[model samples]
Target: MVSDPVQQPHVPVLLRPILANVAPVTGTWIDGTFGAGGYTRGLLDAGATRVVGIDQDPLAIEMAQPWAGQYGDRLTIVQDNFANLDTVAGENCPEGVDGIVLDLGVSSMQLDLAERGFSFLRDGPLDMRMSQSGPSAADLVNTLEEGPLADILYLYGEERASRRIARAIARERAVEPITTTLRLAKIIEGCLPRAKPGQSHPATRSFQALRIAVNDEYGALAEGLMAAERALKPGGILAVVSFHSIEDRMVKRFFQLRAGGTGNANRYAPQLEEESPAFTQKTRKGIGPDDEELEINPRSRSARLRIGYRTDAPADDIDRAALGMPGAGDRKGRKG
Candidate 1:
């Protein structure tokens, strides 16, 4: 049986910086990626009047029920993706939210549960669906063409030997379907060299690539950022904690463009008209975990936090290309 995510111990990453930057949290807030209820609880404890916790995973909502009642009406749980946060907030809060917090990527709870199939360390079915629906990692591994599979590994995971690993997967799956975590890990391991001390596992990149593809994480993130802009009230705080370089890059660029910081980096490019900035950047650069957080949770090493405050200007459409979102064409094995 799957365990309760809320009951499980999870330290919210960059909680200190988030709270400090978005200080005096008084109005209703929305925890967009309400995994394990860590950020929601933290916000409530930090003096928020109310918090709407949103999660795509049913398990998170189910787990939250046992503890959510303690706050009575102050805490509301919604079953939906953050990409639809604006709609969810309108239906639940209606007045618009004063703050929004998004902690991106898979949660520690999902990774710890073997049956959830997010981790390669413990063997389980190769299912990496965040919403617990749609095509699973097993399906992608067993069915996708070698070229596409290679593309996912290369573009999503930044694996240098993606072609080699993809060839190995194709060769193995033809004999029998790759259906389990250990089975897939073993295949990837065979393609890569043994890891040195302190190095990540051989299957790390392949597993990450498969998980991102299975969940359409990048697509969700791009849409969710825009959704947050629409959902937040003027002067509202938007705090986002991202893990890994790809995620950080997207968040950084999103804030930059929304704050009217974007322009042609090339000196020869023609000057462009400036639009009203939507948000004011709170942090000039991404904030990483402090030493105390690092000591408490080593996984926070790759974490980065970026924050912005919504301006009175109306929300504007963002050029997805400007946000550094990896193109779908990249997944189709197209060379730019």
Candidate 2:
């Protein structure tokens, strides 16, 4: 049976950076993550007349639903993946929006819940699906071939010991299909060498990889970014908060490309495309959480905030390939 994870206090990272870049103004905005409605509250208090908050988790929607009456008609909550932002946002706020905020990564609430299976520190089920649908991490670990499994760990989790982990998982599954978070964590820990100084747990990367693969988190982010680009009005602000290196890299590259960077190049005579950049980055570099924020919220340490403006440039030829997304080209995204 499914159960709700205990709600952890969510302290949004890089709040000042987001506030500075977003500058809410007196119009509508989209809180793409809306975990606990922290960002949405900030936007509304900052003078935004309306805010549309979207999340894939129904629990999150339920948690935020009570706040609807508090904000009156100013708040809109839709349960869907942020990647499907185009369809969801279009249906809810067809008038187009002034700003968008994407706080990417697993919510602290999800991690705090041992049963959610997002944290290696806690024992729980192997399910890591954000939407509660699709093949779960358990299914993949128990059923997928070793080669494909290794590739998933390598590509999604960026785990260096992907092959070894895959081999170990395959071996363990043969004895008995790997189930529960602790069992998988133990298997991964066994496959790794002894830690040298202040090393992290061996299961960290595998858990991260499993979670990403189960939810197709990277693919979802790419689709969401593209959708935001489509739904936002020209000159509207778009801010993204990425919690991992992979997600940050995607955001950084997307911003660079949208801000008009060359695709590829040679030494001297570069093969350049004569096209205008779509976005102008508000912050030259990604902004990280400050000492104060890190002290208060340790989870904010790895967070990075990047902001840009929507340009009038065409979405076509914007190099959706760099986003490394799947099913993104399909304009008709899944329902919330």
Candidate 3:
């Protein structure tokens, strides 16, 4: 039997634009993130014959059971990361999938649960593992070198005071292990001036950095986009919704490269041969939530949706360096 959490409701961000852009949703579709079953349910309701729901979090898969059974065989929940989504879809669909939708970053469901420790607002264990296993935020905080820690803050969170925060963390952990969200938040808060009105908390960037490192989110996103390229059938649609600037930039570049929109970075640099375009840009620009959506869910404010349609050409490997993926050199010690 399915255990539905009625108390925890999640409204999928930018559902309208996704549906409108990829009109006539039919055949099999994969909801790569599958948080709270919002997109999966949306696809099924919109006319998809079958929807395969994939999520790294066991809790997300488990929470889906309640309404999932109603869809019966139409919805298949997989306990895996979307980076391997091609293999999962191949095993289940066999004919390939018609559409793939990825909603990146921490889910609303996870953020609300204090025990999950995704939010700095409430105190909880500093374990932000989406899979609920492996090395956690606490592990990185209490053990990672100040250099790598600072790099993660700077590159992943775009934190300007990364070095200072890392130094503070190094000093704090010497006195006591950073074990909870509140403790880490307090340490980060100490590194910066108090927030002015309408400003985000001082710990916001550090927490975002730690969460990205703990989950290897950027790595997953890079691989997952390529996996989508491999899994999508010709004419299939790939839609991604990102919550922050870094994520949005990655998605924009992926589509640009795949669609042959990117040219030489420097005019003097010899032009490199271009590969066959693998995707056609479906949305010329990133789509944002309308005011109605913002009025309904303010969390959608930062969300941006970008989409592309697969071409008949075979999928090729994308150079990570070209995609602006944050690297070890992003650390202060390494040379470019």
* Model 2 C-alpha lDDT versus the unseen true structure: 0.79
Candidate 3 or 2, higher lDDT? 3
Query: Could you give candidate 2's per-residue lDDT for residues 1-336 as a string of tens digits?
Result: 446556556677787778876664668899999877889998898899899999998767876666667998889899888888878877988778889999988888778777777888888888888777788889999999987887777666667777888898999999998879999998888878876787878887788878888887887887788888888888888899998888888888777767887664223333447567778875669898888898999878889889989889876433445543322122232111
Off by over 4 Å in 1: 1-8, 264-273, 328-336
Per-residue lDDT tens digits for candidate 3, residues 1-336, read 223333745789999999999999899999999989899999999999999999999998777766788998998999899999999998888767999999999988888877888889988899989998899999998899988888888899888888899899999999999999999999888888899998999988888888999899998999999999999999999999999998898898889888986564334434446888999985579999999999988989999999999999999877666666766565554222
Q: What does the lDDT read for residue 291 in candidate 2?
A: 87
Query: TM-score, each model?
Result: 0.94, 0.89, 0.94
The weakest ten consecutive residues by lDDT in model 1 span 264-273
Question: Which of candidates 1 and 2 reaches a greater TM-score?
Answer: 1
Of 1 and 2, which scores higher on lDDT? 1
- Runs in model 3 deviating more than 4 A are 1-8, 264-272, 331-336
C-alpha positional error of residue 289 in candidate 1 after TM-score superposition, expressed in Å: 0.7
